[model samples]
Each structure stands twice: as structure tokens, then as C-alpha cells.
Target: MSGRGARGDADESGATSGSLDTVLSFVTGEMAFDPGPYNDAYLDRRVTARIRRTEAETYREYRGLLEADEAEQTALLDALNINVTRFFRNPDVWTVLRDVLAELTANNRTVRCWSAPCADGREPYSLAMLARDDPAIDANRLDIVGTDIDGEALAAARRGEYETTRTTDIAEELAPLSDLDAHVDRDGDSFAVRRPVREMVEFRRHDLLREDPLGEFELVLCRNLLIYIDGDHTRDIFDGLAAAVVPDGYLTIGKSETLPREFRTSFDAVERGAHVYHHC
Candidate 1:
């Protein structure tokens, strides 16, 4: 009877020690910001994964490690923010952007674009390539800014070097439209974005949730970012992005993402299939 009681008490204690709220509180209090904007299940899954990696039996133990080790904090944050991206990803989206660019540069000398949460610079660099290939627009006239919350990712973006597999992927995707070899310089097993394309884009560290959009942009690409956020926060983020675009400018989100119902009146869908919306 005594042994059973002791085991029961230990189980209860373990459960208490691994409370999700405790881990969240520690992260929020220590990080000085609420990560609640992210989906709860997504956060839980990542936290669980991190706990497993750390071999911590309880959330409390993991929280202690997060508090004591800066590396662990970075690891946890990186795990939470999924940065999976590829150049010319979702080819149809780029086709819409190319058409938009043609119209945007018709009357203006320079067309400005902002790629928010631009992981590893692929999206913005892809934009630069499109502008370079377009006869209507001079690549030099494109002022593109790629911003991400991860400084390390931004650093990688600045390097502009990608493995052969990724470069090959870009080449295959763009083969129908343009010669990929023209835009990249190949090194043994890696490829570097050519100077022309790399020069047109500037990569910086920016947080979409914490900071306002940089400035008025002719096009804003916020793809593959909203699915991680909860509904309310997603709406709030859309509001910020809509406000950032010029009156007639274009906003392209992830193919799977949709604007909140409240924003239906503000933005007219330019291409329903491509998820391109024009700010009114």
C-alpha cells in the first residue's frame, strides 16, 4: 500500500513538472514576449521535440536549461520558426509577380518590393532574377528588400551560395521561362547568385510581428508564414501587410493561406488560384 501511494505521488509530481503552461510562462517571461501568436499545437509539438532532444524528463528541466543555456534558447526558437524555402517556389506565384512587375514599372522608374520573413533570401533573389530577365524593367531599377527574424538565416542569405541540389531545383523550375545558368555562377558543387541579382536585393533582420512594415511597397510577398500563426494573429498580420502596400499594389501570400473575411472588402483578388490580392 505504501509503495503504491509513493508511485502515485511521483506520477502526479511528474505531470505537474511537465505542464505546458509552465514551459510557456518561462519562455514568455524570459524572452519578454508572448509566442502565443503561433498555433498552440505547433508550439507544443516543437517544445516536445526540443525536450526530447535535450533528454529532459520534464518541462521544468527543459525550462531550466533554456534559462541557463543561451544555445538551448536559440535552438528552441529555431525549432519553432520553420524556415523551409526554395528558390522559385510555387512557380505560378512568380508568374503573377512577373505580370505585376510589368505593370508596376510601366510608370515608375523604380519598383519597390518587400519579402517579409524571407528565409535564406531565395524568394527575393528569385524576384531579382525575374526583373533581370524582363525586358520592360532594368534589374538595376528594382529595389528589393528581404527581411527575416533570424540573423543566422540573413547571414546565409547574404552569402547567396546554395548546394547543387537546390540550384538544380531552381534551374528545373525556371527552365520553361528563362535560362537558369545565366543567373547563377556555378562552383564545384554549389551555385552563387550572380552579381546582378544579388546586388538588386538587400537582406536585413526584421520581425513581422514586432515591427511595422518597412515602407510602402509595390509588391509584398508574405508567403508560407501565416499558416504557423493562429487565426486572430493571422488577421492582425494581414492588416499590417495590407497597410504596407501602395493603394494599387499587390500582396501575395502562401498558396494555402487566405485573407480574413473582414479584409475581403479591402483587397480584391487578382488571381484566386495564385492567392494574389490587390490592395484597394
Candidate 2:
């Protein structure tokens, strides 16, 4: 496994090295949740954190806990899903994406966009807001699909609700490009995306590791999720992503992630700083 867990030898909990494998097998075989796509290290780190939090003295205990507690299963899956995101998280990247969408939708043609692992629907909904606000783009013709492995996250996405405080920050941060005032209806303490904007986006449950890319897209935002994946499945995943983009379409990845060297011929680096590539 991932070499003695996250706590190293200091971890007195019986959930030591290789114990995560036993837990994983139990979750898959008994709990009906498969974590096969995750790297050993990533799984160990995330699962161990959960183990510590649940105060399970041993990996065997954690396995038994998972069997008895449905909530723990959901909690463990949430931990592994790693939903770290915010609306317009990077303004500079959104600025670039705006321009890219402009060119892709030049003739009022329908352009499809995929935000895989779209955490809590913020990214796709942000894209919709941006499209709706930009007069130059035909927002009605834009189609955005957000997919994530977490069903709980997907449920939240469909609800299209967010804390007013977060949306308020986005309104100020994003400025003239887009704002919540124009795209969301405020409730008591939260905001919900307007129907027009929500209509442009759809959410689905998808496992990026085991499933095929959903469809061809003019823009694919597969950011932040690749780092947790190990090398064994990296290239195959990259190959699928490469194949999913329409010719000349764009693929934007996390700042920390890079295209595999072998894909240099298939996708040309178009925005080096933003880690965007154009399918050639």
C-alpha cells in the first residue's frame, strides 16, 4: 500500500500499511462502494484521515464500522471524493475561459462543455452565469454538463443553492464579467441559480476512472481531480480525455497537473500558464 499510512510509525491505530486494502475490499464487496480508481497513496491518506476521525482503533474496526454504519460509508465516500472547490476559484482562468468560449461559439452554434468532477456544481453554474452575462456569446446555445462521483454532491448541484456569503464574494471578485445579482435569486440566507442559468447546466454521476468520457465537447474542464490518481491509470485517463475533445476544442486542467508527454502530438499547448491545451 502507501507505505505505513499517513501517520507513519506514530500511528498506533491498527490501520497500518496495507490495511487500507482490506478496508477497500470490504467497502467494495460488502458496502457496494468501489474505490478501485484511486491511487493507493491517495486512498491511504484520505481513508486514514477518516479512520482517525471516526476513532477506529484498527483497520478491522473501521471495516466493521463501515458495515454497521451507513452514514460512515457515505462519510468515507465523501472523504475520498475530496470536494474542494469554489465559484470562479481562479479569476484569471475564468477570464481565459470566457475568451475561449467566445471563439468556440462564434456563429451562435451550440457548444458543449464538460466540467468533470464538478464539485457542488459551482464551476458549471459559474460557467452558465458567465455565458448568460456575456452579450457576445449566445448563452441559450451553450450546454454545460457537470459530472461527479459523489451522489450527495450531485444532489446539492441539482438544488443549485449556495450560501449568500460565498455568492456575495463571487459577485465582488468576478466584477463586470458576471455577478450573482443577475443570475441568482436570493433566499433568506442563501441564493439559488435562476432557472434560465440552471437550464444551461446538467449534473450527472460519473466515475472518471472507470467510465468513458461522457461525450465530445468544445470545452472540457477536468481540473484539480487528476493529482489524486496514480500513474498506472494516468495515461489511459489522459487518452480518454484527449479523445473526448472535438478537434480544435480546449481542455483545461488543474494548475498543478500536466499533460502526459506522449499527448504532445494530440493536444497542443495553447495556454501554458493556465494549463489549457487544444486538441489537434
The whole-model lDDT of each prediction reads: 0.80, 0.80
Query: In model 2, which regions exceed 4 Å deviation?
Result: 1-18, 57-61, 164-177
lDDT of 1 at 17: 66
Q: Model 2: how far is 38 from its true place, Å?
A: 0.8
Please give the clash total of every predicted structure, in order.
0, 0
Cα miss at 169, model 2 (Å)?
Answer: 5.6
Q: For residues 1-280, what per-residue lDDT tens digits would candidate 1 score against the true structure?
A: 1111111112576565656665777777787546778877667778889988986777777878888999988788788777889887888887788888888878747778999989999989988888878786566667999999888889999999887563356556555346778888877767888887798899999888878879899889999989888887887788789889988888999998888888889789898799989988
Q: How displaced is residue 271 in candidate 1, in Å?
A: 1.6
Model 1 clash pairs are: none
Clashing pairs in model 2? none
